[model samples]
Target chain A: MSNSTSNTPEKDHKSSYRAEERRTLSSGEEEFFFDVKTSDMEVNMGPQHPATHGVMRVLIRCDGELVTGSQVHLGYLHRCAEKIGENVEWLQYLPYTDRYDYLAAMNNNLGYSMAVEALMPGLEIPRRAVLLRTINVELNRIASHLVAYGTYGLDIGAITPFLYAFREREWIQALFEKICGARLTYSYIRIGGVFNDAPPGWLKEVGHFCDVFEEKWKEYRDLLALNHIFIKRTAHVGVIPKDMAIDFGLTGPMLRGSGVDFDLRRDMPYMAYGEAYEAGAFKVPVGSGEKGELGDSWDRFYVRVEEMMESIKLVRWCLGVIEDGPIIGEIPKVIKVPAGEAYVGIENPRGELGHYVHSDGGKVAVRCRVRGPSFTNIAVVEELMPGTLLADSVAIIGSTDIVIGETDR
Target chain B: MELQAIHDTLKAAGVVGLLGCDEPRPANKKEKDPGRAGMPFLLVDPAEIVPLLTACRDESRLQFDLLIDLTASDPAADGDDLWVLIQLLSLKYRHRLAIKAHLPKSALSIASATAVYRAANWHERECSEMFGITFEGHPDPRKILLPDDWKGFPLRKDYEFPTEYHGISCE
Candidate 1:
């Protein structure tokens, strides 16, 4: 090009560009190219995002990759279940309870039924019905924890565990379907007792499922619970102290995961759990920080995984103590609950699900208040999200295992 | 501890505004009315809620460290007062207590329990929005389960269901 006379214009342009660059560098103006001015950017996750297991929105403010602040906006799935409870009769509210925590409908059913039954002083739940209720509730707890385990793995970018977890969960759902007509929202546990007795061979099938699940449980532990990359991403990520756990009103696995050996089923037993606890059928598994700090994300996830096995033990115990008898109490078709108010709290898979029913000697309840565990458990995310990375925020939210339907209801 | 013992302990602590205990009574043959057969609850003055809860939590014999649930209920469509219910649990002693504060509907406001337990923050917000009760010193008193510009308190007995919201039918 230098030898070619026709390329003079090209040579002039190249020389001028090089001279400009040299002059700018000599003048100390190159910092403008390397320096970046930043402000906190607000990012909205969910009401539709996948990380949020349901329709919940989290507004997060980030400085680069660090989360500086967060605000959780709920009510997206509010159906006013409390109001419906006030309007419906005593027995009609059971189906409404199933919608709050759809994944653990049996637990919700048990909670509401127990609360209403508390008012009927003369009502008696048959022995066989109590055993059946225990079996169904414990099995549902396993199914609920399986979802928590699977989705938490999915949140941490492990896909195989979710498939394995759901495969087992589906088997549980099928057992429920065989007993009741509906699979997802069975509403099987009624006010006095259960809707019906288990179908023939169903209990034996449950025993078989327990045997198979014990083998698959080991595979699940190896696949995701002990994976190196999963541990690195989750362990020590969102550590909540024991004081904070109690201060926030957290219960169930959330409280136990903080190394607080308080299980409502054992401490305040209900629905034959007291008998089961006395029988030494199962043990409460508290987080010991096996891989990281106690109350961290992995600790909470591990607690749920361990709880599934504990629930299996509980189901097996129920099967061992089964007897043939009536499956329901003698509840009137048109129920008229005595004039009184009772608050019955049962140990749901997530936490203490309390039902406060106030009656004025009428067919309908004057006030029906539900103390949803997911509602209280999810509130701590606001305190946990700040000072975490954007990716770890997902881990913390997933660890809470909140169903938005329960949160909003 | 039994309900009587807990109440005696609270009374001994010089806790002001103790309105005595409401015991359970079964339905009688003569009255034919199913009497209050539910769990006994302590009735306290709304103004002294903070002190009452503080005493319940701090007393050596009665260490109610966990605030299990906080909610409010309206008795009737035309009731004169709303009852604010607070359930407390002690992890150390494994005893539970239920305290109800009678807030007159004419003045539906009370001291927020958030000072005693941080868990009360969200519970107070929910009570405030649903029952139209004003928690005097709550940090964040925003509407929790309802929209920002909701028309009326939905949980109140006298609340009227709205026909539409934002061009969408609610009925």
Candidate 2:
């Protein structure tokens, strides 16, 4: 209920108190009794809050219900992943990569592996291994997006979609378990190739999953994306303009939601994405602001939902072309990368996951820097939160789809 | 644009501190590795970082609107200078350029690139706290990923890891 809607006698007295004080001052008499002073309240909404999605604290200063200022406090979950990367050997650092962005561990593994591989001049990834990497990465992308979709629904007070989204995500985890024997942080994508190939009937099972996911994707769209309540809460809230989005260095759905039409997978192709694009496997979906303002929370959320279908298409295309061959490349167990520095940026589900490796032509790395997308993408929230309502701030944070592991890594 | 062409354009635009490009060309069969195998970068003086980056963003032919990454890499523990690395991307031209600025330990300060690109705000903050390189003119110069009262620069080569924090054992 707003102050204007409630016309109680007490509120009328409080509202007219200031004018009455001015009028009495002119008459040279003091009649000040009511002392209703309201100032901006400082609210700490993080470090243990569910809306934060992880251990992040936002020190929000609000005037009544409107947020006046916000300062994001991080480092609660910082494990110094980069410091660990520099200390560990070239191949031994793969498992550490899985810990950062634990939801999309495969993409993290691929990013770290690709960076190390770039420093090795003679390393060649096998064809079958490349296809498998693409398939697993895309599958992980779907699983990551599903979590983003489901959690965003929960953030908007829709609970059923959370369970529905998790059901399909479990299937992807099961498929990963069959191959790598780990559900969440599967360090399957090794340096030159994958740790192992898909099991005998794994590809066919993936095909079945693609078919079932296509049907469920529509249900998700209807249940949450097109729901009136969800649209109303998200549309026109936390709208990031195109130039602002680029200026903040937002990637993935956040950038595309502003209609930037740039995807590292399509524009700056790596892995099998180039061939898949040439084969007309999938199309990059940019938000057209069908519901409300462009680049709002709804557009960003919708882009993640739509990207799930495109990922399925890319997976299907990879399933069509995967041939029987060696899965892992011929590299020594203890590897020594050449003396050089290389930076490899890949399209993680959240955004651009970059790994900059500096090697001394030895067993250990000199410096390892990870430019995590969540770390950069989360900076925009400080700009978006001041003018929005308290609830809309949660919606905006959910739309960013940041993993604290990636943000603090 | 290619690295060579981008270098020439910066020179033509009268952007100072044009300190030659470091292209990662393949070494000879019998030659030793030069520790340069990734993207080509242009080395620049630490004092001219702001104007050179502003030129890169303002030049129509360059139009490097996106600041991809801003970081500092400590090449050696005993080295006198720290290397400040900046990565820029142009959505219009779809090309990338890397800029490296050498900051001596005696004077580890440079103009903040936040004036040219807002994305550099957090990146510069992280670099300052990590490498102890002060970004002069930065709006908010605070520790990003570490505690406000934290001790030493962890990413520095010679820094020692803390044994305890607030009476809790870190080891």
Worst 10 residues of 1 chain A by lDDT: A7-16
For the predicted complex of model 2, DockQ is: 0.68
i-RMSD of model 2 (Å, 1 decimal): 1.5
Q: What is candidate 2's CAPRI-style docking category based on DockQ? A: medium
lDDT of each: 0.87, 0.87
DockQ of each: 0.68, 0.68
* Superposed model 1: Cα runs more than 4 Å off: A1-37, B169-171
Interface RMSD of the predictions, in order shown? 0.9, 1.5
Alpha-carbon runs more than 4 Å astray in model 2: A1-37, B28-35
Error of model 1, residue B72, in angstroms: 0.6
Per-model TM values vs. the true structure: 0.93, 0.93
Residue pairs with clashing backbones, model 1: none
**lDDT by residue (tens digit), candidate 2, A319-389:** 99999999878789899887777778889999889888888778999989999999999999888876556
